[model samples]
Target: MFHYNATNLPLQGAPGSLGRPAKGAAKKPPPRRRRVTLYGLTFSLPLLAWQLLFFLAPLAFLVALSFWTVRNFQMRPDFDLVNWATVYSNPVFWQTYLRTLVLAVGAAALTSLLAFPCAYAIAFKLSEGARRWATFLMVIPFFTSYLVRVYSWQIFLSDHGIINALLGRVGLGPVPMLNNTFGTMVGYLTLAFPLVVLLQLFSLVFVDRRLIEAAHNMGARRLRTILEVVVPSARVGLVIAALFCFILTFGDFVSPLYLGGGNPPTLSIMITDTTKAGQQWPRAAVIALTMIATLLAAAFGAVGYAYKGRAR
Candidate 1:
């Protein structure tokens, strides 16, 4: 019998050997992950640069401007709290802020409520071709200038406008629609409704048809299915739509001015008024900062709510 000692044998170039590489052999390739990360960073650089240049720089300047002093209609770069103090102390500023907040919230709520049904119909009821056409039509509003559209609305919403003229025939209304909260809401809807509907439609269309079918098979009615299943599933889009509506309405100048007649000025109107009154750019900057803060809070809160549960 032959006794073989495997451990005593030479291991170099042997099958499954743990020996080091030969002198002339290539070193192991570096990790692809590091290369991939580098590529991603390279692609993202332009966007980062753009944001830094346009958005962050302007935002920082606006903050600095708020702390600046205005003397004889000229902005003087100074570290002063007078602008903040004056804005905070004024009852009118607070009132305008509150009014703007209320109106923005109201517009968001109203626009979402109004847009949902339209979106649902487009998503679930329409054929593919019809859906495409409807979407195209929704986009058509954007082709015309928003200012032009607002002006056009004036012709229809005014006291002696076509709507009121028709209403007068029925002895119904010369209703005070224009130059009020109603007009402001109308303008808000005009701006946000189509966009909201499009957002909701996209969300709804991507929903699992199987889930909807399962609900139907389980004896869930339309309204119940919508409230329980559809709404929950599409909550992110809906909330985002409402958030956009809030942001747009909050910052809108045209609607409140042209339609609402600037009777009780909003924050945007206040900014203009501040600048116009005495070129109080610092005060305006304070208002702008306040608005930016409010918007950021609302956006963060809504996004948090939208993505409340499930996986990370």
Candidate 2:
């Protein structure tokens, strides 16, 4: 009959304490996060140094050389605006610049358009084994020297070449394909087509299949679905492929010189012409710098468009 209730019993610990920690007790600190460390810098420094040495140093030297004077076919370290003024004043330079720009833009557009269907088939229509084989075949083109490939094309594209011989057998006769814009485009396609197809296939394969299926479920036609969903999903890859084509075509000297017969010389040809004409290396530097600037502007613009509205 003398049992005590636990609730009514007095606590034997600190005053006003109800089995809780003291207010003055030390609290645990939050874990520290390292944004950058010596470990990361150790790996990144080598790459940074490489770029500094090979890219930045050379670029800086070229810029300085462009402003220097050329006396007696010798480049002298003297600040002069003669090279810039002369290059900018030349009508031929401007004309060649315009032509190079047009050809590069044309190559980018043409290559992207041509590569799309082949990439789509590889990505969606082929089985895994077939896809692998197709990709492997595409890669085979890269194994051969690009110069050798261009040379070999002469065998097929030149007048009375295999193509024209076949055409002759069909009573169609020969067609002039070489030493013209057509031949230049063919060479550009040879350089860029397979690469574009591969890029597009890689992007297309990673697209969400469910989104495509949902488009079909909503009564959208296959073409419409691809236009609305697939193309948008793969826009980055497509744009980048086109950009690469532009860069390659813009700076190319071989195709335009050999295939197109250098009828309308590009910027690369202009640089060579400048250098060979009294060894005007400073003026050549100016042309090279202009090309670099154009490529940078195009690349920045394309990348901005491709990644618009994308998350960081």
Candidate 3:
């Protein structure tokens, strides 16, 4: 009988002698990882370039323009405090800013109010197929051009428009719904409602139905279950919708221009009229900067709230 020790087996085929790797040696990393990273960069480069070209570059130019002066309405590259001083000291700017803020906030609130029940029905009550159809119907309005839709609202709310004409059939006089803040709010709500519904519906759909059932099993009431469980879980979506509406409405020039009737213009309209119509680029840039800062602050606050909710 031959006594063969395992340690002496290397004599037959030593590690690395028969083209096998050493047992304890580190293997070379495959080049495929680097290729994957290169591929990712290649895919994302277009988006990065677009952001740099259209967004960041223009934002930088606008910031620089804010600090520059406009001599006799000709934009100059020289630094000056005159524009900032003018914006800060002007009562009209502040009033317009406040009005725009109020309108934006009001519209966002109303949109949220209207969206919640619709979203709840879609998320909890409707079958999946019905929900899909409902969502499609909600989104149908967006297929039309935004300007045309807003203009349609202008016609709808006009003195002799459909709404007023309907009221007239009921022996009611024409209501003043066009060319004012109320009309502006109606327009904002119409545009923003679908977005709010979609966001809230997404939030509601993903909520663990089990949690609500669990709460109810513990004798929690329907409203209490919703207020305590559903609302907290959907806070992120709510915050996002509110912030999006605020940012969009705050910066909206077109709706205000078309609907506001120049009685009490929004800050966005003021910025446009100042820059393009009045040729006050520096002042317009200042207003732009202010609007940007305000939205950024709101966004940061929303992020903080969301983060805190997550942490809790």
Candidate 4:
């Protein structure tokens, strides 16, 4: 029997069969707002241990050591500003800093120049199969150790080496390609160029070929097509390549050390020897901090370049 009026159905659980749902029905509650937290002593303890041991502990020590003084090659834990003062006062420090900056800029410029042409060829001129092989050849050097590859320049440019010997065969005197600033710039270019090309290749794939065709149809010649059509399409790629070139070249320490040697004295070598007496911690920290600051500035410059490239 039913007792409900026409106006409405029975209320929930009011009684009898009319008000009640069937047995074994399932109900869902509202969704919950989740919070992310690292859980478990077993799971998180190792990560926490590593953060303290490898990261925070060394960083704290380095910061403290930068405030310390060195006497007779002995590191005193007593805080002092002598290392900072000494580093700032040295004329050699500024010279090395400026010289290295120039070399890095040269490297970055050369890398961009080479990468742009190579990238354009790979992206536009090559067939699909050829492009793959070309890309592989460009980047394969990176798989080898940078030291070994850069050292190979010595072998090629050495008096007894391949380039000179080839010149000897040609009855022309050997051109000097190794030693001094020119040689160091070559090393920087060789090391950084392939990476720039690789980065640009990714951007190149996004370029629309139709845009070039449209430009050509509108009386644009080959040079004009590149400047007006292809370049505009690939601007982002070029900026990306330039950014990589700058960062890699500026941050590089090894190329100048081995190739340039202490005669020219790049920033890297100067920072190391000058910062250490007995306690190497403080001056080294300052050098490290300076390098970090320069790197960050380069990063900001890259972002600006990318934005400008996009706008173009």
User: How many pairs collide in each candidate, listed in order?
Assistant: 0, 0, 0, 2
Tell me the tens digit of each residue's lDDT in model 1 across 38-134: 4456777899899999999999999999999988878899999999999999998999999999999999999999999999999889999999999
TM-score of each: 0.85, 0.84, 0.85, 0.79
Put down candidate 3 lDDT per residue, 199-237, tens digits, no spaces: 888888989999999999999999899899998888888
Residues 172-291 of candidate 2: C-alpha lDDT, one tens digit per residue: 868999999999999888888888888888899998999999999999999999999999998898889899999989998888888888877899988888778876889999999999
Candidate 1: regions farther than 4 A off: 1-47
lDDT order of candidates, top first = 1, 2, 3, 4
Residue pairs that clash (backbone atoms under 3 angstroms), model 1: none
Give the lowest summed-lDDT range of ten residues in model 4: 28-37
Q: Report how far residue 132 has shifted in candidate 2, in Å.
A: 1.8
Clashes of 2: 0
